[model samples]
Target: MATVENRQVVLERYIEGVPKVTDMAMKIGKIELKAPKGSGAFLVKNLYLSCDPYMRGRMRDFHGSYIPPFVPSQPIEGFGVGKVLDSDNPDFKPGDFISGITGWEEYSLIHNTSQLRKIQPDDAIPLSYHLGLLGMPGFTAYVGFYEICSPKKGEYVFVSAASGAVGQLVGQLAKLHGCYAVGSAGSRQKVDLLKNKLGFDEAFNYKEEADLDAALKRYFPEGIDIYFDNVGGEILDAALLNMRIHGRIAVCGMVSLHSISDPKGIHNLYCVVPKRIKMQGFLQSDYLDKFPEFLEHVTKNFKEGKIVYIEDMNDGLESGPAAFVGLFSGQNIGKQVICVARD
Candidate 1:
């Protein structure tokens, strides 16, 4: 069989802090179209790759994380949508469309089919939505709000990093559940997007606020019933001080602490005792069984114009490094995606 050139984004070394484009190097390699014999693997042409905050953890050296860290000199992997080219696995046939953990490369040979999901494309939905709304980020929001937080109607809801991928969906879902929602973003544009476009009850640019606690108080005079904590650090401490009795806090991401060598501890956690708050951390993979229901619910809302998803798309595999780096710098307005190819 003829081999094809594969351009891949490889981790140059174990990163210590926030990942930069220089930490990853693009290389041109070659791959056989066919999966290795008896490898129980499948070959795929990557279409779209997702750039997420959690990927920063993978850039570090392996240290007993829930997911294994990416090895230096190897292709970095993340959630992506792709078209199957060749398969040694019976369940995945040639021409099948799948989405899951894939390398930042033109072509990838996926050995584990367990995480792979077959995509049933619909004209009503964009294929890239699978990497954002209908994919992990959307599912993360759904599970965190509904399952973990157990939100109620008319409650005050707050979302940190509100304009990003997961935060955007969480705010919308809170509104759909009849809650008063407020979101915090890094910039004025994202704040406007949260309030004007995504239907949040209120939104603010955290960077412009001198005191985050004051900002939260301004938005939630009655106190927050459910806080979707995305940024963590000072924001979380502020939310801690502002949480109502029996408030629920769903810890999603700590982007602020990801690059910091010495992470700050949350000091106001003592309030969780007197307030009887339920604060929990979660991974979306914990709620895989709920994906089907989540997909149906989100897809319906999306088609009905009840939910809106924004994406910051970069073109080609070569753009993967910069796109991934942008997540930490808050350069992406919404979901950061790299368009590897169009199927």
Candidate 2:
């Protein structure tokens, strides 16, 4: 079989503090198109690669996280959509469309077939949505809100990083559940996107708010009943002060503290005692059994125009480093995706 050139984004070393594009380098390598006999690996041509904040954790040498750290001088692996080119595994065959964890490269030879999921294409929905709305981000929002927060109608819901992948969906889901929804983003544009485009009842630029506690109080006069936290730090501390009795806080990604050497402690955790609040940290994989139900509901809402998904697409493998780095800086307006190939 002929060997083809494979372009990849490789981590140069373990990252400290916030990540930069310089931390990763693009390298070219060659690979055979076919999976070797008895290898049990499937060869796939990656289509869209997702750039998520969680990936920042993998860039470090941390051992406590659910996913392992990225190996130095190797392709950074994350969620991506791909089309099968060859397979030694019976479960996946040539031309099969799948989305899961794959290397940030033009093509990947996946040995762990269990992580890959077959994509049943819907012409009405773009295939790239598999990396965002119909995929992990959407599922994360679903599980965090329903399973973790247990939101009810007429409750006040607030989402940090509101214009982000998971936050945007959580706010929309809160609104759909007949709860009052509010979101906070880093910029005015993203704040506008939340209130104007994403149907959040209220949205604010947290960077502009000098007093976050006052900001939360201004938006939620009755106190927030459900807080879907994405960017943890002072915002979480402020939210704790404004939470109503028996309020629930779903601890999702803490992007603000991810890169901090010594993360600031949350001072208002004592409020949880007085309010009888429930704050829980969760992972999407914990709710895998509910994926089928989540897919059906979210897909239906998407097709009916009841929900909207926004994505910031950076084209080519060359753009992967910048796209990944942009997450920490809040440079993306929505879900950050790198389009590596169409097929």
Error of 2 at 184 (Å): 0.3
Q: Runs in model 2 with CA error above 4 Å?
A: 261-263
Error of 1 at 187 (Å): 0.5
Candidate 1's residue-wise lDDT over 131-215, tens digit each? 9999999899999999999989999999998989999999999999999999999999998999899999999998999999999
- The C-alpha TM-scores of every prediction are 0.97, 0.98
Give the Cα lDDT of each candidate: 0.92, 0.91
Any runs in candidate 1 off by more than 4 Å, and if so which? 259-264
| Clash-forming residue pairs, model 1 | none
